[model samples]
Target chain A: MTARSLDWESGQGERKWRRRSLWALLLLVPLALAGQAYDSVKTLLGGEDLFPRQVAWGQSAHFGGSDWKLTDLRGAFGMSSLPPDSVPVLADFSVKVGDPDLQKLWLGCKVMLIDAEGRRWSPTSAVSLKAPGDVHTCVSAIFSGARRGDTLNLRETFLVPRQATKTIRPAVGLASERPHFLFFQLEKD
Target chain B: MMRKMANVILLLLATALCYGLQVSKPHYAELIGPIPAYGKLGDAVVGRGFEARAAKVAFSRNLKVDRYGQTKVFTTGGIWAVVTVEFAASAQSTTVAVASWRGPTGLAYDQTERLSFADGLLPVAIDPGLPKKARLIFEVRPDEVSNATLLISEKLMSALDSQAEISLGPVAAGADGLPAETVDTLDLTQPI
Candidate 1:
């Protein structure tokens, strides 16, 4: 074949390869965007309640050595009997110290109150309450340690507004440790 | 020659755009953003150069300290949250520092040196898999008592992978379904 003809053939092959590459790139851009769009939609649909599984009141969750049972949860204005005009929610849990390991373990745990707006509320203080047939009264207790087979009644209050009460969840975690939490869902019943 | 140059420029622009998107997206993200979770004892958290396990822990207003072989009484306006952490270093040794507390208000409180005399975990270096336990103390505010998280980062602004933000559980409610209220001031004279 003539040298001129061979040069023309090589140019044509190069153009064909370039065209295929351009088409491949054009196809890839949309594919990537579709994947991203799928992720964005998924996030938009159910991104709010990701980690702490929503649970109802009176639901028992087992973690480590003890079974933490959340018995009751109520909303009020302030942390105590003194009234507030705004929003505050209180949660009560019974931590029954079981086994020898539980007695020695540090029982100082914290409760996080998450509102509909995704605001987390921690207890201002922990106290023991004396309930005389439905009338609740708060009494101060030395919250240091727990003994085995001992049922310790713990209380925590959150300052959350009334409008944000639609979806409230209480997440429990050990006071000194990091991000592993015992999540509870609030039952509408 | 002009067409080749134009194609090269387009390829470069495409590569730059991809890189921009890749860098902008986070590695780990919660749909609502990354909120810290509560962790229990014996929970081993593995970070970049170290694996840490929280051992013994205590929260008190008055810390009983033995200084210069003498028992001294040190008190705080707030509460003292102490944790005994066992840190095991990987091949790449780095300083493990107890940095800050992520309060319930979604605020970060840094370590205060007021109780520097107290014995706690200081930023120290670790060797490969050689575990070293130390006492780390944090002075927390009264309002922050309910929910706080301990942020363990090697460097101040380290990447998320190199840091471990632990969820120290919140306070439990009483049987009456309300947080038991105690007098603001803890009885410091009482033996801890």
Candidate 2:
């Protein structure tokens, strides 16, 4: 076989196949670009993880009189005057950036619960912002109540001014001298 | 080669778009925590009701020390939280075995016997058979906020008073068997 003629005859088909495959990939490039552009625009214009669900779990505390100075940390709930079961015991938090200024704000609580059987449930999608001084509302969903020693910790991104009070009731018996619910706050830390 | 370069560019663009499109922001909310809980003082400290609702709950009675501040919670039905006393007080001792009453109609002491203390607060555990919201009268004596220092803030007595009612605080023995600090019932209100 003549070298040049034989090589050409064998590889002619391979060259055609390579060229076809490369062209196909090049065509796909623009489609991917377009999809990405659409996604970015949507996100920047108020469209990202719009809502987040939180799961409540156990919490513990230790003390020796250490002070804490803090920010972006909410305060405890202590509205004892309310009727029993008027409010939720555990809640998580979400963030919302607002219009023009994109003023940072909190949306609504993500009600959290863990059943006696150790099953966990947190259902949150979207929470509407409130009209007053950048406040939002979250309602409690009835679930099996929490047991003694069980705990709920809400999200820690909201700012609570000093000594704010929140009302809550216990599902179980509570000792009058020993509080059923306890709150740990950011002091001079 | 040109086709290969174009393919690479496509993948990068797709990745960036996906990242940008997911535009949710998280706003931080602050929550306070570890409120104090007092316990283990003996049988004298227990909750109210057949269900023992106050068995483990702790409540703070707001008393005015000469009118510094006052907080009163009274109801006719349902249940009101009250502090329970576990033992008789010693004339020299200042600590009373204190607790809460569940299903309480008013702020009465826990045990059957009512031994007055130096503290103005009189905790009364309501008899369950009675009305849920008792007719309560909160009388702030002139001694309220007596220990509060305006210059140096945060004293311990007010802090305790802010939580559980003070039971056996600062007493001297009197010939009448009542602690010197104990206020006359006539001066204080009823169902305290």
Candidate 3:
């Protein structure tokens, strides 16, 4: 009888130990999944521009190692070369270089026109507007070799709907500062 | 004793079932391969991002390209297979960047990089409501010309994305076993 009683106690202990192990394994499953998905989650977040650092027109904001200010957002509605019902909107920017490595910092630079509805239009070359001699495009300005404290004029032409010009804002994104870009508020809006 | 024997048999059967499942499962690459949108040569094979229609196919031994008033001749040891394709974006502005020529024996020949300087080639950008024509050139063996397939996609690593596979029907072989309609030289300077 004593042996049987001891066997019952040991069986109960063994069952409790198995139950505890199962609960520990259940907890580890989620931890292992999170560990494996850490890099992917980081990459997904880093690749997307989710945060916008807002800067009002004529106000400078420090981004991508430079101070960027939107100087002008003009739309040419009656351009004969552009498609019907579309206008060529030029976004002009004045950037003060704080770092000499513009080429590396501004690599994969993109300037876009975004409307209130979140409709984004990239820069287009379909419009044949001869920019001013001193004005360089966002991509071309990278190779200009501007020194620190030098001011550079940059422009980007986008073909957008004429209706979108009223609410559109110019935004700048650089490769280094992706996921967090400069979104300038238009004075007209 | 009978219950022990039955349990052993059931366990053996379960193990065999698990082994069968492991052996017959699809490979990881096959599971993540490009989703194919098949069509005939003339039919428009529409993918998720773009639509492609192969208009014509030409075979030539030499290709003449003009760049800035300078003419450069490209000669191939095999044959130059030029496919004229029209592409249009479905929703947004996208670039159709990759094309390949799959032979009858499942060998894939990528669009020739020799014609990289030529305008209106692969990696051409298309906007919505506007269609663009481009050329996909490949140098392939003579036997691989018949029953060929043309594959087009946005980029090279298009896993789980749509890929257009247009079938080119059988071709007639010449007396010399080359494609019968092959031209001696193709002048790419002329507009398609």
Best by DockQ: 3
Error of 1 at B91 (Å): 2.6
| Residue-level lDDT tens digits of model 3 in A45-113 | 767566889997679999989999999989877668445667788889999999879888988788887
Q: Report lDDT (Cα) of residue B89, candidate 2.
A: 16
Model 1 scores a C-alpha lDDT of 0.59
The window of 10 residues in a row where model 2 chain B has the poorest summed lDDT is: B145-154
- For each model in turn, which proportion of the native inter-chain contacts is also found? 0.00, 0.00, 0.00
Q: Could you give candidate 2's per-residue lDDT for residues B1-192 as a string of tens digits? A: 999999999999998887776554332221121123233322222211111111221112332222223433222111122222222211111222233231112333232222233232323222111112211222222232122111100122323221222222222434543324433223223432
Interface RMSD for every prediction, one decimal?
A: 19.6, 20.8, 3.7
Docking quality category of candidate 1 according to DockQ thresholds? incorrect
* Second chain alone, TM-score for each candidate: 0.64, 0.18, 0.97
- Please give the C-alpha DockQ score of model 2: 0.01
Q: How many residue pairs clash in each candidate?
A: 34, 66, 0
Candidate 1 ranges beyond 4 A from true positions: A1-189, B1-39, B66-71, B173-192
User: What would the TM-scores of all predictions be?
Assistant: 0.38, 0.18, 0.75
Report the Cα lDDT for residue B121, model 2: 36
Models sorted by lDDT, best on top: 3, 1, 2
